[model samples]
Target: MSDSRGAAMSDGRTATKGLAFHRLSAPSVLALARGEGGGAAVEELLTAERSRRLLLVRALADSLGEGDPPHPAGTAPMAHRAAWTLLARTQQRAPRVFENILMSPQTGMWLSLALRRLRGATAYEDAPLWVVAGHLSALAAAVGARAGLDFSLTVPVRHGRVPLPTLGCAVFADAAEPWGTAQVDAREGRLRITAGRETVTAGPEWSRSAPGWHAVRRLELEPTGPGKVLLLDELDPYRTFPHPSPPRLLSADEARTWQELLTGAWEILRRDEPQSTEAMRVGLMSLAPTPARERYRPHSVTAGDAFGGVMASRPDDVAQLAATLVHEFQHTKLGGLIHLGPLSEPSAPPGAPEQLFYAPWRDDPRPLGGLLQGIYAFAGVARFWSVHRHAADAAYAPMAHFEFALWRAQVSSTVDLVHRHDRLTALGRRLLGTLRERCEEWMAEPVPPAELALAQEVAADHRARWRAHHLRPPAAAVQDAVEAWRRGDARPPAALAAPPELAPVADTRYLDTAAVLARYRLGAPAADPSDIEGVTAADLLLARGDLSGAREAFVTQLAGKETASDAWAGLGRALAGATEHRDASRLLRHHPERARAVQSALEHATGRGADPVELATWLGLGPGETDLD
Candidate 1:
């Protein structure tokens, strides 16, 4: 935790040589692979991340070489050098306070972004140079305030707001400029900021009424016996991933709601998953709330460089909130581990054809790295639901059980595919093997028959939908099938049996309709399906276990001008449920893209539609079969 631990040598080598050669014990690695790292392991990760951030900060400074500035007054090089000098002085006087500012999640994010911008790896349109380098000045201001130091520095003001990295933001009401700099003078724990002719001042304690300063809110929760604090950060420009954004501060009511939801979620995790609770208490530092998206489907993300930070939309309930924490923390842990060593070979060469694979949780195909992350994340999710199901009430239990059943299978199958990949290194193979063992252990656990069936149906439906959305059959094969049907041939051409290749489509909407409907059914069995946004009547019938009704509904829809991929996948689900029309069901489920392509080609050629089931039956039958019946 000392400043020297992360100090860079003259040649830019990290002084902390142990970090370069760090290795986790076998037991610790196994626990992490199973999504159960204790506090000690997390502490190691946090320390490593802190060192990485320090290295990045040094690199950022180096990138701005010590050369004469084109605009010597108030340029990035000048500001960066001034900030560095102030930080070194502050570290000498108040080491702990300096460390706190250095380790702030916003500091890490800013370091990565500023370095990228300096190195020309990213573009920032019309952004003033001070906007990137001024972060160091903001960090210095925060440290000075905390350490009761006397200092004055000019920091960037973006969109009329001056944000002190970890402390809070100062708003300028009279300032109309889009980008400028504010001079902050701090002495004896008091802060005064002046921009142009306007000025604002605040005492040691922040206050909304203290002229124009907004305090960074912190949430304190006692989930277990000990208290834990997390910053409800909405004012940090670096809170978002990849780049800086304008602050989206929460309202009073919204902030209170977030506090309540986080409290309940922490309590649930404390009661059910104490090990995970410990890991989070040590490593999960801040939560940045994004605008809410689709209901019951909260989006969450963790950046590789921003360790201990999570950016998530509001959740539907406490259980979901807790699960989101678990899911994102898994990503946080894996990101740290990958930074320590190689997991897979350097990413596939650009335009590599075999790079992308099926990811059960996403709408589009994922590359190998994304697939690995998803596998680890959903494995944690499956583990969460596996235990949460036992604690859930009757109304919620089905959904919990279904989630566990579905993800266990998905993670296991994905692990099987990744294990055989040629790119995994020795350490990567070891980690994957440990993860596979945990998945195998979970796979043996029994679920209720009905919930298990629903889980299987949802999985199959997603795969079929993904296929229909992303894969395209060979054009020659499709044309041959169309021609044979036009000639009134008894069977499809043998060429139609060729496997499909990926020609991804752009329409990804409604791909998760089946899963969404399943969740709704499990939560409120009698809920009206027509009220749902993406759920169709046929989907409702299938969700309710009315196979015959769903089959007829889908058939009627297909008989018309409807060419939606969901209809084809829906018919496949209904037929699979009925256990009749096996040939047609198999074709629709496995080669949905092929079947749809041939059907579209035939319709385009003759200016007339054909029977959906009959077309599938014909294509699915062996080449030797002579009769459509």
Candidate 2:
């Protein structure tokens, strides 16, 4: 990592953005963003970022000329013309030069494109582009750079539509691998590109597609029949030079499975989400199978770009495949939109709380922005199941219904939280409004009462477990509360202190819904529901409200020793429900979310003393019941 304090750091490599992978010292970036400590710091940035900083200077000065643009994200990356057209919205609250140039859409776009400039980036955090952009934008304000003007950065930085036109041509690379040297030509409409000994070709029509958006600036693909595919997974050198994990070429069986999965995804989108189908084809170019795991599982992930993609294993069914494909694509859409506009508070305004809140879906607490992103993606998942439910079997349809109801509600609450923020740009508000409307529309769709209950229970359980794992009460307040309880005070304090700081759950266990679905489809009994680490396992126990059992499950992890974080949360819940209120209160104080979840479970959970077996049955866990703690 560069010191970022004195000199602009360089590794002899350059990115697309004029600035190299440079990180302005943390204090420097933070100070600039807050518009703190005058000219000296600004001068340093000007020295480091130099001419490259000018791009941001033009982009921001143009889009936000003294006014906040209406459609910050939608405005595209321009300063001069964009500023003129966006004049209506920027009239008030328009940022003057050197203001808190925080979360500007054009600024974000410039930064993202610039960040992409880093080739085979080994250590990305060393010089984060976002912070660099913030510093540069600040420098522009300090130097007073304006739109349509020539500018330069002394620092050196070096630096795709769906269904690309198909052509027939043989490709060759001068080097051993077709990375920097690869070339493609389609003289008569066939396409080929050589990588190592392999050459991927399209005979006049590169019609194959790998299945997968939003106001996502829809990209219309040339009607080349179907989806597009990227033959080469290892875009950079293959010897693990750049990315964290290299791509694994699929085995023949895996390839066939993938092709089938793609076909299934295409059908689903063609029927309900045509926009998504196009986005998948036009945006995503590469598909690489996830590395082998000890257990059979399906996984899908994508970096913010529309290009690279990953899948873990062949799913027992295509529906499972479709859900993850759509989920990550929504993230891609959101990433793109964020570049175009700010969806939530991008950074803390000194004196404003930088508090992280519990998200039901994650083991760790997330910033509001992170929470918003997950909810939006899951809400999209809900929409997916809305259609998929009808296509599912009797045993599986209920699960689909539950998924829709649960995520829609979750997204609605998240959107509501985001909506209340006064700092949201007009475009951000519009996007959230649309999302809210969509969530509300789908949430009202009918589902079987029993299944809806199941969905609510799972959602509620996860939230409780998350709270237990994360939320904490203030230490001083907790001490006072402990004292009061010791004195046998019947009254709960008016307002308690902030939650205690606890370590966050690093990587939580993922739910094996696909496994559950497979068992259901085969008319086979579900094996015992293992206590999963993270949100899902805790969810299974907490859903039943077996307070003591949950505590035991956590403290002992009967199945296996799990994370201490989970144990503390489980113990907190069990203790809270018992007469020994001190331990419970302390635990709850440490895990405010856990406390809240428990309270909610008690309020909504039906049938007290429900056998563990019956409770598990109700929760679709097993035919056999197991008690809570």
What is the alpha-carbon lDDT for the whole of candidate 2?
Answer: 0.43
**Index of the highest-lDDT prediction:** 1
lDDT comparing candidate 1 with the true structure: 0.80
Predicted candidate 1 versus true structure: per-residue lDDT over 1-629, tens digit per residue: 23345322123344456533345666667787676797888887777677777778767667766442233264555566667778888888998888777877778888887777666666543456557767777887777777888887877888889888667888988888788788889887898999988888876885343668888888897845689999888988888776667778899899999999999999989887788899999988899998777666688988887888899999888999999999999999888888776678865685567578988899888878888899889888998998999998887888899989988998988899888688887767877888899899999999999889888888889889898888888899889889888898988889877778887776476678888888877875666656666678898898888988998998887777867777888887788744458878877877778778888888888887688888877777845333322
lDDT score for residue 62 of model 1: 73
lDDT of each: 0.80, 0.43
- On TM-score, the candidate that comes out on top is 1
| Each prediction's TM-score versus the true structure | 0.92, 0.54
Which whole-number lDDT from 0 to 100 does residue 609 have in model 1? Answer: 69
* Total clashes for model 1: 0
Q: In angstroms, what RMSD does candidate 1 have relative to the true structure?
A: 3.8
Error of 1 at 497 (Å): 2.4
